[model samples]
Structure formats: C-alpha cells, structure tokens
Target: MVGQPSAYIIKKLIHDVETVVGKVLEDRSTEAAFWHPDRRARR
Candidate 1:
C-alpha cells in the first residue's frame, strides 16, 4: 500500500481526536453550567 498509514498511526490519530473532542465538550458543558443566566437565577 503506497503512502498508507499503519494501524498504529491510525489508532493514534483517532485517540488524539477523541481526547480533544472530549476535552472540548467537557469545557463547554462546564462553562454553560457556570455561566448560563437561567441557571444562575436559581441560586
């Protein structure tokens, strides 16, 4: 296979992408919970 990535490379790429996406989702949810005006009103 010319120019094809190995299985390890593909797995690493997928893992890296999932880590980044998970972090982004976690940050967004944390920010929304902390700063949403409607949620703040309940306090």
Candidate 2:
C-alpha cells in the first residue's frame, strides 16, 4: 500500500516536470520566431 502512494507521487512529479519543460520550450520558440528577421520585416 505504501509503495502505491510513493509511485503515484513520483508519476505526478514527472508529469509536472514535463509540463514545465514543454512550456519553456514553447515560449522560447515563440520568442525566436518573433525575433527572426523575416518575421520582423513583416511588421
């Protein structure tokens, strides 16, 4: 029973980390696109 709770906690932590990393990558990509010369020239 104890192992089940620990396993659940670990899974949740892993999921949270993955979510954060995905968000960071998405934000970086958006920033890169905005600063890209072709995109900037259109503005």
Candidate 3:
C-alpha cells in the first residue's frame, strides 16, 4: 500500500484473482446448465 507494486507482483495478483473468479463463474455456469429447464424437458 505504501510503495509501488512491481510488474511481476501486479501480474501475479491479477492472475490469482482471475483464476478464482474464473473458477466461481465456471461453477455457476455448470450448475445452471445442470438445472436448465430445457435439459429436464428433454428427458
């Protein structure tokens, strides 16, 4: 917070945050697909 963050540090932080966000989004999409009405209607 006090000093400027290096490029490497910033990239790492961004990568970590994106990875977590991607995982959450992927999970939600998978859950939605699993529960989609069309899927149930097809059965």
Candidate 4:
C-alpha cells in the first residue's frame, strides 16, 4: 500500500519535469527561429 503511493508520486514528478523541459525546448526553438542570422537579415 505504501509503495503504491510512492510510485504514484514518482510518476507525477517525472511527468512535471518532462513538461517543464518540453516547454523550455519549445521556447528556445521559437527564439532561435526568429533570431537566426538569415531571418534577421530580411528585416
């Protein structure tokens, strides 16, 4: 019974970490897309 709760908590923590990492990667890619040299040159 105790182990079941711990397993659930661990799964939730892993999910939260994955969500944050995905958001960070998405933000970085967006910034790069807008700030790349070729894109900047067109402005």
Q: Pairing residues by index, what is the TM-score of model 3?
A: 0.53
Error of 3 at 14 (Å): 0.5
Off by over 4 Å in 1: 1-5, 30-43
Clashes of each: 0, 0, 0, 0
Could you arrange the candidates by lDDT from highest to lowest?
2, 4, 1, 3
Q: What is the lDDT of residue 10 in candidate 2?
A: 90
Q: Which stretches of candidate 3 lie over 4 Å from their true place?
A: 1-5, 30-43
- TM accuracy, model 1: 0.56
lDDT at 38, model 4: 72
1-43: candidate 2 lDDT, tens digit per residue = 5759988899899999989876776679776465565764676
- TM-score, model 2 to reference: 0.60
**lDDT tens readout by residue for model 1, 1-43:** 3476697788889999989876776679766566565775677
Per-residue lDDT of 1-43 in model 4, one digit per residue for the tens?
A: 5759988899899999989876776679766555565764676
Give the alpha-carbon lDDT of every model.
Answer: 0.74, 0.76, 0.73, 0.75
**lDDT: which candidate is best?**
2
Model 3: per-residue Cα lDDT over 1-43, one tens digit each? 3375687799889999989876776678766456575764666
